[model samples]
Target: QASLADLDILRRTRRMEYFRIVNWDNMLYPQYEDKMQKTIAPDIWKWLQSEAKRKLAEKPVAHPAVRAHWQSIVDGIVPFGYNVVEE
Candidate 1:
């Protein structure tokens, strides 16, 4: 069973990974430029900046199953189970 401390560490690691993935200044796919210009060009940069700031300030929320499992472990009960299924 993972302790709360362990879960917190994992959460921080995931947050760092997320930040790394989204930390790009520009979109990589130039092929999508035309579509982006039509749909998002006007406010895309402003929206991105606001979202980055908001996400940076936001706290990560654990999944309900994960939280239940943690609590169950703490209470010495049959802990909830989950799988990290990646496609």
Candidate 2:
């Protein structure tokens, strides 16, 4: 059986490899962003923005500073599977 440290190293290595494979074109190709941008319809993009804003509005924080900070945290989240990426 692998040791804890060995398993941890393997997990990190595999994660790196997975992202490298998935984002290879985005990393190497300059037109990747342009192509991706073109694929998102304007109406869909607008709807997404509106939905995000509505979701944020639903969770109201009383203080201005707290609200701003909370919004920043919410905006940074990317949903993956059943959970958002912690980082």
Q: Which candidate number would show the highest TM-score if scored against the true structure?
A: 2
Model 2: lowest-lDDT 10 consecutive positions:
78-87
TM-score of each: 0.23, 0.29
> Can you write out model 2's per-residue Cα lDDT over 1-78, one digit (the tens) per residue?
456566567668776321111345675777776433323334444444465566568857557765665455457432
> Residue 11 of model 1: what lDDT?
70
Clashing pairs in 1: none
Estimate the TM-score for candidate 2. Answer: 0.29
Report the lDDT of model 2 for residue 10. 63
Best by lDDT: 2
Off by over 4 Å in 1: 1-40, 60-87
How far in Å is the alpha carbon of 54 misplaced in model 2?
Answer: 1.6
**Model 1 poorest 10 in a row by lDDT:** 78-87
- Per-residue error for 22 in candidate 1, Å, reads 20
Q: What value of lDDT does candidate 2 attain over all alpha carbons?
A: 0.48
